[model samples]
Target chain A: MSFINYSAKEINCKIVYYGPGLCGKTTNLQFIYKKTRPEAKGKMVTLATETERTLFFDFLPIALGDIKGFKVRFHLYTVPGQIFYDASRKLILKGVDGIIFVADSQVDRMDANMESFDNMKLNLDEQGYNLDNIPYVIQYNKRDLPNVVPVAELNKVLNVNGVPEFEAAAFDGTGVFETLKSVVKLVLIELKKGA
Target chain B: MPQSPFVMYDEEFKELTLIIEKLLREANSKCVYLVDKDGQLMSAVGETKDIDATSLASLTAGNIAATGGLAKVIGEKEFSILFHEGERDNIHISVVGQRVILVVIFDKRSSLGLVRLRVKKASEDLTKSIEKLLSRMQAGAAQENILKEITDDDIERLFH
Candidate 1:
């Protein structure tokens, strides 16, 4: 859920990056954290295992400038994509305003992608959120890999809602900002419609 | 939107801040803050200059959510209070009105008993104030849509 603080003239929204393990969800956030101006970003917090796999989640709060004088900030979070962490994933989705489904585009990971996508829908449903109504976009990450599936095929399975989808190589920063911007725009537009 | 977005106005913000500030003083704590269940930092008081309030807020909520999940598995509705002790400092976290998390940070200058007592009183007042604010938001929902006044061009301006 978004938090609108009139006292601070700020609007804070939560956006989660979700996918199967090793889909570059954390990499997307790290790239954004590294590139954002110091003044515009907060410390990136990663709750990860000793080997650096996300244990609970990764959080990065970034200010996306002002809209009609109210400073707009987006708190980007990535859930632990490993399947056994479904409980943790549900907790992270408790009050999400938007979502970015980071799908690994590898041909061999198709089943993993489908399974994660279904898991996301189930989690959101349990929390009273319907995937169709929420503001969300899909990111086909790891596009640099040679064994990746075609965007058209990935969309056929993951983008049933026909939400905006981006082909991204998050480690190299390709389409990272574009994906973020698209989702943010969709979130704002949804907010306006709600208002 | 199954759940309404959380909104804070100037009046309620001031009231909440005052209550937190009073709790900070009464508990002899180093910091006190309120975070929504979603991890948005609502208001904070005390030695926050060196602290990363945003990260703290996010983690605190995560802690509560994880605990709450555990509660459900064991067939409990929720765990209303959580406390953590460190070598030099401690944290006392409680849920207020089932929506907000009240956090108190302290050190040797304070005792958990005192912090808990003060937090008990403060939580009551905070819960009442939060109920009022939620109602106000519902009433004001029809007043004006801020984003409606903004144009697509205005949104495009943010990126540039």
Candidate 2:
């Protein structure tokens, strides 16, 4: 759920980046954190295991300028992509305003991507949110990898809803902002409709 | 989707800050803050310069949600309280009114027992305050559109 504090003149929304293990979900967040100006971003917190794998989630709060007179802040989070972390994944999606499914485009990781996508749908359903209605975008990440699957094939499996999709090499920051902007725009549109 | 949008007015914010401040003093805690279950910082009090309130709020909410999931797997209704003991500081989180969380961070000056005691009483008051706030918002929601202040043009400019 979005928190709109009239007294504070702030609009806070949560967005989650989800995909399979090693799908560069956290890299997308790191890219955003690095590119964001210090004045516009808060401390980036990563709750991860000793191995650097996300144990719980990675959270970054960013100020996306202003809308009207209110400061629009977006809290970006990435769920632990490992299959064993399903419980943690569900928790992070508790009040998500928008989602970015960072699908691994590598030919070998296709199954992992599909499994994670299904899990996302199931978790959203359990939380009483239908993926069809929520504002979301897809990022076929790892595009620079030589073994990557074709965009057409990835889209056939993951983009059934035909939501906005982008090809990204998150580590290099390619398509990162494009994917972020697309999802944020969709979220703002949703907020306008709700208003 | 399960809950309505969390909206806090000036009066309610004042009341909440006061309560948190009192709790901080009474518990001898370094800081006390209120965070929505959705991870938004509502109100905070005490020394927080060394603390990153925004990040803490989000992580605390994640911690609570994870614990709640654990509670479900164990066949429990909910785990209302969570405590994390560190080498120096400790954090005590409790669910208030089922929507917001009251977190108290303390150092060696206080004990968990004392923090919990203060939190128990503070949670009750906070719960009532939040309930009142929500009811007032609901009552006036029909008459006033909080989003009315935001226009289509304003939103359009955001993307550009």
TM-score of chain A of 1: 0.99
- On residues A1-195, what C-alpha lDDT tens digit does candidate 1 reach at each position? 989888888888999999999999999999999999999999999999999999999999999999888999999999999999999999999889899999999999999999999999999999999998999999999999999899999989999999999999999999999999999998887877777
Q: How well is each residue in B60-106 modelled by candidate 2, as lDDT tens digits? A: 88888888888999999899999899999999999999989999999
For model 2, residues A104-153, the per-residue Cα lDDT tens digits are: 99999999999999999999998999998899999999889899899999
lDDT of each: 0.93, 0.90
The CAPRI quality class of candidate 1 comes to: medium
Which parts of model 2 have CA positions greater than 4 angstroms off? B1-3, B140-146
Best by lDDT: 1
The per-model DockQ list reads 0.76, 0.64
lDDT at residue A46 of model 1 (Cα atoms): 94
C-alpha root-mean-square deviation, candidate 1 = 1.1
Q: Which pairs clash in model 1?
A: A1-A95
lDDT of 1: 0.93
